[model samples]
Target: MRQEFDEEFEQFVRRWSPALLRVAFLLTSDRGEAEDLLQTALLKTSRHWSRLADRDAAYAYVRRILVTTHTSWRRRRRVHEVLLDQLPEHQAGQPREVEAGRALRALEELPPRMRAVVVLRCYEGLTEAETAEALGCSVGSVKSQASRGLARVRVLLDQSHADTAIPEGAR
Candidate 1:
């Protein structure tokens, strides 16, 4: 029975890790931190495996754990900034990459809970109720946060675009 439980959990991890990692990456905006976050979530989930009566709902359960854990970490200021001697050079001519970088930077500006709400609602395509459940918040809170977060992101992106735009007739 113990071996069966272990195998089941392992298979679930193998199947869902990629998707979960993507969520973590969006939440953290750093690949290394995302991996760490997902690992921690998985560990927590495994510990509660026996209590999970519905295997079909495991993904939702784990996702809720991920969001709560991330918000808690942010509250505790567990994330650290590493200073580098020099900035890395950006490759030119990749419009998508530039846009994605801008979007990520915009996300970084949001408060942790708001950022989680936006990522789960927009990027993950979760409905307001689903996002609220994941964040352990009321649906009304999710709605307000999503609205404000998206507006802030748009403002940030527009500012980024303006800063990078070439002057008219100056090319």
Candidate 2:
């Protein structure tokens, strides 16, 4: 029975690795950090494989671990950090890369909880109740977080636009 579960778990990882890794990357922004985060979450989730309610819901289970783990890491991390003018090597020079980078940078400014709410709701296309379940919060909290998170993102994006805009005839 244990060996069968292990084989099933391995198959699950092989099937979902790409999608889960992408979500991890989206959540963390740094590729290396994302990989580490996902690996940790997967390790934690696998320990309770037989106890999971549904084997098909492994991604959701793993995502909850990822979000909570990330939140914990953020709390432990220091506030001070340097900013860079350039994109990470993996993302540079791609189509729409500049705009996407700006948006991601703005997203990073949000508090950890708010960022998770926004990513789960908006990025993952989860509904309010679904997001609430994922975060272990009330549905009302999910709604408010989504609203507040969007407002903050809007402000940040607007500011970035103004900062990068060409003057009247400069274009």
Candidate 3:
């Protein structure tokens, strides 16, 4: 029975880790932090695996864990600056790449709960109810957060565009 439980848990991790990692990365704009966040969520999930009644709902269960854990971590951590060894090189890329970078930066500007709501609803394509469940909030809260978060992202993106735009006839 113990071996069976371990096997099932291992398989669950293997199958779901990539998707969960993407959620973690979206919540945390840093890859390293995303990995750590996912690891921590998975550790918690493992402890509760045997008690999960529905195996198929495990993904949603883990996602809820990820969201709550990230929220808690953000609340407890103090802001600190990391000094990089060298400046990052800017690459000249296609328009889509530029737009995506702007979008990600805009996402990083949002508050954590708002960001989580937007990511879960927009990026992950979860329904409002599902997003609310993952976020431990009411559906009405999810709706409001999604609305405000999207509006803020749009404003941020527009501001970035204005900052980078060339003057008329400057080309």
| Candidate number achieving the greatest lDDT relative to the actual structure | 1
- The model with the greater lDDT, 1 or 2, is 1
Enumerate residue pairs that collide in model 2. none
The residue-by-residue lDDT of candidate 2 on 62-148, one tens digit each, is: 988999999999889857366999866765467488888888998888888999999998888999998999999999999998899
Stretches off by above 4 angstroms in model 1 are none
- Ten-residue stretch with the least lDDT total in model 2: 86-95
Tens digits of lDDT, candidate 3, 3-104: 999999999999999999999998887889999999999999889899999999999998988889988888888583679999978777678888978998
TM-score of 1: 0.95
Per-candidate RMSD, Å: 1.3, 2.7, 1.4
Against the true structure, what is each candidate's TM-score? 0.95, 0.89, 0.93
- For each candidate in the order shown, give its overall lDDT on alpha carbons: 0.92, 0.88, 0.91
Give the lowest summed-lDDT range of ten residues in model 1.
73-82
The list of candidate 3 runs beyond 4 A from truth reads: none
